[model samples]
Target chain A: MELLANLALGLETAVTPTNLLFCFAGVFLGTFVGVIPGVGPLAAISMLFPITFYLDPTAALIMLAGIYYGTTYGGSTASILLNIPGATSSAVTCLDGHPMAKQGRAGVALFMTTIASFVGGSFGIIILSLFSPLIAEYALTFGPAEYFALMVLGLIAASTISNASPSKGLAMVVFGMLFATVGTDSQSGVGRFTFGSMSLLEGFGISAMAMGLFGVGEILSSVGATRIAKIDSSSAKLLNMLPSKDDWRRSWLPGLRGSSIGSFIGALPGTGPSIAVFMAYAFEKRVSKTPERFGHGAIEGVVAPETANNAADQTAFIPTLTLGIPGSATMALMLGALMIHGIQPGPTLIVEQPSLFWGLVMSFWIGNLLLLILNLPLIGLWVRLLLIPYHYLYPAILVFLCIGAYSVRANPADVLIILGFGFVGYAMRLADLPAAPLLLGFVLGPLVETQFRRAMVLARGDFTDVVTRPIAGTVLALAAAILVWTLVSAIMRYRRGMKALTRNPTG
Target chain B: MLDRDYRDIVAGLGLTAIGAAAALYALFNYNLGTFTRMGPGMMPVSLGIILAVFGLLIAFPALSRSGDLPPLKIRPMIVMSISIFSFALMIESVGLVPAVFFTTVIATFSETRVPLVSALVLGAGMTLLTWSLFILGLGLPISSFDWPF
Candidate 1:
């Protein structure tokens, strides 16, 4: 009864003329950013964060949330139409989506992706509406020790999931932690890594780093790549694009399973659509009757990862909204935005700002509907977005990135740091180290350190509290298990490869 | 293909050296307190040591490897590095609108043979739209370089 009443209040708030307009605007902007290849939702939201400072909190949050999920839906368009992925989450879509396009099924791929996105997005919203309050309430019981443990779990999980060598991932995490220590020490008044620079006092800006790494790095990588190709659409028509009966049958199960997997993974801190999409792809490959068809225009391949990615994109909001711990880079930026608005997210947010919480949740469903409507009839329009030449598109993205970084603190040094990180990011990419773990490390590094210090203070310098407390202990054990499992598996694989090499030395 | 083990060795050694340098610098400037009560230098110093260890591990494999990996493409690296630096340098003086427009135009010309007029128009139009939406509509206070000083 209370849930229903709260939802009614939410509906009342979200349906207001002002809030509705912001929702529409956010979704539209999201699709535009997602359509463009270089910029992702993380950059878009970070760029938009400062602009939302003047708006009502409800409207600001609704619009930001819309952009986050809307980008997931829009990202697939480029993957299917062109061979390029608009965002990292859409990388898997390129495998089968491009093949489908080559087979003259571009319209069908777009249509099915839309339907799958809607289904997955709605399911994620439902999970959010049902479980967020419970999670928030549970999170309130956490002390500094529990928080530290949770951060450990988040860091380890992120490192293990990174699509690179674990050593590199660990190294990046440590490097990020070091970067987090660059500003003034919160406990003491002394500046550690600032080296007497005033700009370093505030530490590195998240917006600057994100813009430099993802935005500038993207343009740099595109310098010698093939020019963005135009698709021949003389035979393409919407009427003939709807999914067949067999397509529907294959899609429904994967959509449901993907949503379930995504929501579960997303609920955990630090995991996001990238991991969810990868997991969904691996799962689909394992279960499909003809698994070899996966990378060659299988409709199920398109539906599974697309569904999971969107679902994870939406549900990843749970931890960010409830616990003040961002589950992804985009969520981290949203957390930054919320802090700018003077809204501290946690258990108290539910009681203090029920309208904001419910209003944002309700707007998600409305935004998903908006995305479906916008993407389907306007599929051709989004496909046309790919026609823009890279030369023109990348430079504009670079401008937004610079402006966005500068806006964070109105500092030029922030822009420099972004560029520095962009070079580092490019190097990391060249070395085959995943950039996602670096982001995870940078965002979560300070939180873990702060919590660890606080726990020690509270326990009178006793480190055992992290493992002595029941909740904290359980989480620590889980993290340990995951780390151990990963190490064991990696070693096994290494040994197997070595053995294969030795056996084939002569043969 | 770059030998994974060899690459790891080089990375590990480099990290170790960097970590050692950082530790020495911090120790000279900041005090390292007891293990029970960590000072400012404690975490970084400890992290540096760990990195050094990993670096040594990486170096062990490189020491044993005889073959060399192919050299990385320097063109993309140089191009990208310059582009990022240019973006940071020009953002404020040129203003977001003109700065981005000019950067886009230059970057486009670096690779493909885009018509100059088309690139200019696209860059200008995008800059205008972003300026209006982010600055004017959303009240971001983005300044224009076109104003008479």
Candidate 2:
């Protein structure tokens, strides 16, 4: 009954004139970024960060939430249509999506992806709504030790989830922590690594770091290279969008399976959509009767990963909203945006700010509906957008990147920060270091430190309390298990590589 | 070019220098309070040492992996970096329009050189969009066409 009334209040807020408009704008911008290669929703949302400072907090969050899931849906369009992923999470979609496009089934692939996205997204929201309140109730009892232990688990999970070697990912996390320490220390009011710069006093701005690493870094790497997308114009017609009855028969079950997998992974504090989509794809291939057809335009192939990524996209909010812990790098950015608006996220968030939580939830369903209407009819338009040269695309992006950074503090120095990190980000890409974990580290490092200090003070410096308290101890134990697991696996993998190299000497 | 097999070692060494520097700085500069009452220096010093150790772990290898560092596209990167630097200088000094115009013009050269007319048109269009989005829609305070001189 309470849930219904809360949802009713949410619906009322979501339908308001201003909220509706921003939701439409946010999702529209999200899909646009998703359709374009080399540009991303991370930078786009970062661009919106300064803009959100002026809007009502609820409206701001609603619009940002729209962008979050909207990008996941939009990302698959590029994967299916052009064999390119608009974001890293959509990489698995290319496995079968491109194959389907090659087989002149691009329209069907696009249509299935939309339907699957809606289904998986709805599944995630339903689960998020049901679980968040209960989780928040539990989280209200947590102390500083619990929060610190939870953060340890979250950080370890984030480092190990990246596809790169585990050791490199751990190094990136420490590097991120180092960067996060650049600002003035909140407790003692002393600068840690500021190098006496006034700008460093506030720390590295999340907007500048996100835009520099993901946006400008991407442009710098790819702007010089030229690539053309091949679209099957005939299969791109509206008629081709209605998947055959047989196609629908094969889709629903896989969509359900993928949604379950995606939501589960997404709810974990550090694992994200990229891991979800691959797991979903692997699950579908494993369970199929004819595994041989897994990568060759299998409609199931297209539906499952699409469903999984969107599901992960929606459920990823659960950890961020309920626990004050980000489920993914994007969630960390979202949490940063919320913090900038002076809205604290955590257990008290739902109990204290019910409207903001419920209203944003309602707007997500509306945004998904708008996407269904937008995606199919506008397939031709999106394909046309693919043809716009990157050289042309990148210049406009550069201007926004600058404007967005400047709008942060109305200081031009933020733009310089982006340039500095842009070079660093590009260098990381060259070195095959993952940027996602870095964002996580930068966002979560301070939180972990504060909690650790507070817990220590409360316990009178007894470090053993971290392991003796039941919930905190259990959580920290899990973190220890994950750390040991990753280190062991990394060592085993290294040894296996050495053995292979020794056994296969070249003539 | 640096050997491909030694990339991890190089990366690890770089991180070690960075971590050691941070750790040494933290060691000298701030109060290292006890564990029960951690001072501001506690987290940085601990993290710096961990980073240095991790760096050494990454660096120590028998080196059998094979992955080449892709040649950096120096031209576009240099041009783009310069354009951004110039924009940072121009935005506060000249104003939004000229900062955008000049930056867009230089940024285009990062890929293929565009004709002057086309570049000018793009610059104008971008300047219009930035002004409208930041000043008009979002209402950030800044002059649209100030003369820095």
Candidate 3:
């Protein structure tokens, strides 16, 4: 009852003419940016961060949230229409969505994705509104050791769950952490890896790294590969937009399961929608009565991961808003936006700024509704975006990348760093290393290091305190278990590969 | 004598050597007295060692493997390297708009194109849109707008 009352208050705040306008602008801009390859919600949100500084906090947050959710919905359009995933979370969508497009069911895929995203997003918002404060209060008890342990678990989960070898993923994680050490040490005020360069003082910016790795790396890869855009020539009728009765039956269970799984995983720090989407896809396959239907234009394949990705994207905000710790890069950018507005997002935020908090929440629901209404009618327009030539698209994307990089601190050096990281990102892709862990490591590295040092100082250099503290101890134990499990799995897979090779022995 | 795994082995060994040297240099320059209270070199030195170990791991595998070596795509690799280097060099001098426009045009050379005019138009239009949205609207300070309207 209180939730409903609070929500009504939130709606009153968000539906104001000014806030509503920003929400529409945000979703519109979000869909545009989200349709482009390489540029994801993180880059778009970061690019918009400076603009949000002057707006009312509620309106600014509403706009940013709109971009976040809108991008998730928009990512599916490219994956279905062009066989190109505009964002990493949409990668799984390509497997089935592209196949559906080829079969002239592109409209169905688009419609289903929009519906699933709306459902999942609505579910996630409900969960966030009900549970965010409780989760924050619980997280407030976590000490430095607990935080370190949680990060370690996150790294292990990311490495093992990624598409590449655990070794490569771990290597990337280490590389990212090393990169994080390049700037001045917060504790001692001394430089570690800068080698006396003044640019190293501030360390590598997250926006620069994200744009370089995901944005520029994508351009380099696209340049190297030949991709002919596939446009569905068949005219999709309005009647074909809705899923078939059988399709709905197949999709509902997966959608529900995905929402549950995504919300749980999204609440954790460091993991994001990509991980949730992958996990949902894998889970749907594991539990399906007919697993082989999944890579062959199955509607369930499209629905499950799309739902999970949006759900994870929304719920991931819970940690960022309530605890001041961002669960993903997009959320981190949102946190950065809040800080720029002189509003620190943490336990006191709700009490200090109830209007802002509730207003933002209210706007998410409003934003989701706006997205559905905006996307449904605009589906044809979005599909037409696929007709745009890649040559034209890539250059515009590059310009946006450069501008976005420059906007961060207004430094030319940041732009250079973006370009440099872009090359490194391309190299990493060529080596088949996952880029997500690197981003995670880069974002969380400083926080983890600071926490670790603080814990040690508090404990007077007693290392045992890392495990002796109860909550921290449990988290460390979980991290250790993950590490052990990963090692065991790697060794098993290596032995199995060796055995298979020896048995074939030059046949 | 070069083995089939020579390239991988060489790359791995070179990386390992570089990592070790970096670690040693960092350790030598680090103030251990201050490090007792938690210093800058602590994390870097640890990471350097870990990197060296991973490099050695790659080196060991490369040394042990026997196979027909896959040839590195030198052309694409070189093109990519030069593309990146050119972007760094050109971004400031030419400003964001022209730099991005020209760099992207060059990047497209990797693909076989039928008509040159189509590619140029595509690139120019993309640059215009980006300039309008990010620079003009967002005020990113990316262009001097050298071209006359």
Interface RMSD of each: 3.7, 2.0, 4.1
Model 1 CA lDDT for position A252: 87
Give me the candidate number with maximum DockQ: 2
Q: Which stretches of candidate 1 lie over 4 Å from their true place?
A: A38-56, A86-88, A228-230, A234-236, A282-293, A492-507, B1-7, B34-37, B55-97, B146-149
Question: lDDT-based ranking, best first?
Answer: 2, 1, 3
lDDT of 2 by residue, A308-408 (tens): 88888888888888989896678899999989888889999899989888988888888887788777798877778877777788888888888878877
DockQ of candidate 3 is 0.35
Better candidate by lDDT, 1 or 2: 2
Q: What would the TM-score be for candidate 1 when compared with the true structure?
A: 0.90
lDDT of 3: 0.73
Clashing pairs in 1: B9-B58, B9-B59, B12-B55
TM-score of 2: 0.97
Model number with the top lDDT: 2
DockQ of each: 0.41, 0.67, 0.35
lDDT of 3 by residue, A1-507 (tens): 877877888888999998899899889878877776545666555554545544667787888888877777777887888877766789999999889888888888888898898988888888999997777678777777777776666666665554356655666666677778777888778877677899888888776787788777776766534567668645344566877899888999999998988888887765678878899999999999999988989998899998898788778888778867665556756666677567888777776777788899989988999999899888877767767666556655665666567665766677678778877777665555567667766766787788888788777788886779987787678767866876688667656656655676542
- Report the TM-score of candidate 3, chain A only: 0.90
What's the ranking of the predictions by TM-score, best on top?
A: 2, 1, 3
**After superposition, which runs of candidate 3 have C-alpha atoms over 4 Å from their true positions?**
A1-9, A37-60, A86-88, A235-239, A269-275, A278-294, A327-344, A500-507, B1-22, B33-36, B57-116, B139-143, B146-149
